[model samples]
Target: MKTRMLKIEGPRKLVLVEKELVLEDDEVLVRTLQSSICGTDKMYYRGEMPPNEKYPLFIGHEGGGVVEAVGSKVDEYQAGDLVMSFSRSCTFADYFKTKPINLQPVPEGLDMRIAALGEPLACAMHSVLESGVQLGDTVAVMGMGFAGQIMLQGARKKGATKIIAIDVLEDKLKLAKKMGADVTINPAKENLYQTIMGLTNGQGVDVVFEAAGNQDSLNACSAILKHNGHLVLYSWLTQPVTLNMHRWHQNSFKIITTTLVHHTKYERIVWSEKAMRPFQQGLIDVEPLISAEYKLADIKEAFEESVNNDEIIKIIIKP
Candidate 1:
């Protein structure tokens, strides 16, 4: 069958191209349902990523679809199964071929639109788990994007008594409050260090999550981390940023880098399954995070919105 897929020809340029599907023995063909734009996708769209030029590069990974066809050797999934995929199969398309192992069945009754966020949700959950948040611990999430929102909720679920959300955008700060952040901080207007110190009684928080992926946020995180505090790094920074290493060295901080996607396939499989339980139980709220949706044909406009709009937490593409 022929599929129409989005291809990136240059920075901020996208074209819909047709291609015939070729199924491998261990692969399955998925008819796309929902695909979402990620922060990395924005970087690629802006020509910030230095990985490869190779114009017409395939760009989406967070998506869900129904299996339309299965290879002869694919026994675990069939033609009608609803599945979430985490691979570079260029999911911004009507149909794509993927290995069965890269697909996870959406839980019964779960909305496929929300389930398409499995990849990012799992990564956020993994970071929360690795942070080792203890009961009644004071926690702070720096940045109120999708991952930050999810991380704060996960911290709350893990027994954080006082969860602080920090961001410059008032819209994100408001959403953070709605998502159960005990306190919200706007660093642009208030002194972030003084605010966090006052909130924590001058001791700082037990765990500080740096999700903003910038030098300013990193410095702010360092300023408010208590002695021996755990600093959880959750963002993917494409460029290098200056760090306050003196503070880290003096306070003996424990830095935990929780980039779950970098884990081995077997490890990710185990962790992703465990990470999804909270979502399955309805504890992790993702519905409010989906800020916008666009049809596949309007992908160019969708990319423009994602790049220019600061309030958009997530954008879903439906084909």
Candidate 2:
């Protein structure tokens, strides 16, 4: 069968091209129901590709859909099973095929829309788990995007008494407050240092999550953490950034890197299921984080809007 897939022909160029798919013996065919753009996708869209990677390639990794078909050797999945994607098989398309290992079964009774965001949601949740947030501890999330929004709620679940969400966009900070943030700081407008110090009573947060993949956000995260506090690094900053490293050693910060899929495939599958349980059971909210939706054919416009709009938390692509 043929699928309308996205191809990054070059920098700032996205075109939907036809791809003929043939299922392998250990593979499963998925009819994509929902998918969304990731921060990493934005990097490739803008041409900040890795040194070894090139353009004119398939470029999407977060989505979920129903199983349309499965290969003869595939026993873990069958036709009509709802599954969330966990690998890059050009999910920005009508349909795609992958090994069963890359497809995760949707939890019972969870919204398919949330399930469609399997990869990112799972990653954020895992990061929160790795985040050493004790009961009554003060925590801050550096960005209010999709992952950061979810992390804010997850931090609360993990027993962060004061959840401070920082962002430049008012809408995201507003949504962050509505979700679970006790305090929202727009560093663009207000004095972040003074306000954060006042709120923390001059001590600073016990943990800070660097959700925004930029130099400024990283700097701000470092500036606000208490001595020996956990600095949960979540962003995949594609570009090199210069940071003031004096505080890192002087303050004795414990840097934590939480990349969920870096685990073995079996570990990833097991951990992904564990990470999604809270979302499935309504402990965390994802429905509101999805700010917009666009059809597959209108991806160019979608990418354009996503790039230009700072308030859009997450944009779903419907195929």
Candidate 3:
């Protein structure tokens, strides 16, 4: 079958091309219901990705869809089954072919829009779980993007008494407050270190999550973490940054990297299923984070808006 796919040809260039899809026996074909642009996708669109991961890349991995066809060996999925796919199989297309291992069956009662965000939500859940946030512990999430916003709710669920959401954008901080942050800090105007120290009585937070993927955010996260505190690294930093090892060594900080996508196939299946429970039970609210939606034909404009607009949290592509 022929499919319309979006390919990132170069910086600020998105080309929609038609191609024939040949599904192998181990693969399944999906008709995309909704696909959302991720932070990594924006990096690729802006040509800021690493040298090895260059464009003309097939961007986008966060998507949920109905199975349109299944291969002979794919017994678990059939046509019309709702599935959330976690792969770079070019989800910004009318249809995509992927193996069953990269797909998860959407649980009953979960909205498809939220289901499309399974990849990121799962990553946030993994980060929160691995951070080992204790009851009544003070937690701060640096960066109020989709991941940080989701992690704020996760920290709240894990029994954080004081959940501080930090970001440069007031809109994101406002949404974070609405989503259940105990305090919101805009570092652009306010001093992050003073505000956090004051809130914690100069003891600093017990756990700090760095999801902003910037050098300054990382440095700030390290600065405010308490002695022997857990510094959860959730962002995918495409570039290298110098760190202040003096503070980290003096405080004896424990760093935890939660890259969920690197988990084994079986492990990922189990983790994704377990991680999605909070969303099903209303513990995490992703609806407010979806800031905009655009047609697949307007992908160029969508990419530009996603990069230029600070108020935009998450953008969905309806093919």
Poorly placed runs, candidate 2 (over 4 Å): none
Report the candidate with higher TM-score, 1 versus 2.
2
The clash number for model 2 is: 0
C-alpha lDDT of all candidate models, in order: 0.89, 0.91, 0.90
Cα lDDT tens digits, model 2, 66-110, are 999999999999899999999887899999999999889999999
Q: Which pairs, if any, clash in model 2?
A: none
TM-score of each: 0.95, 0.96, 0.97
Lowest summed lDDT across 10 adjacent residues in model 3 is found at 46-55
Higher-scoring candidate on lDDT, 1 or 2 = 2
Please give the lDDT score for candidate 3: 0.90
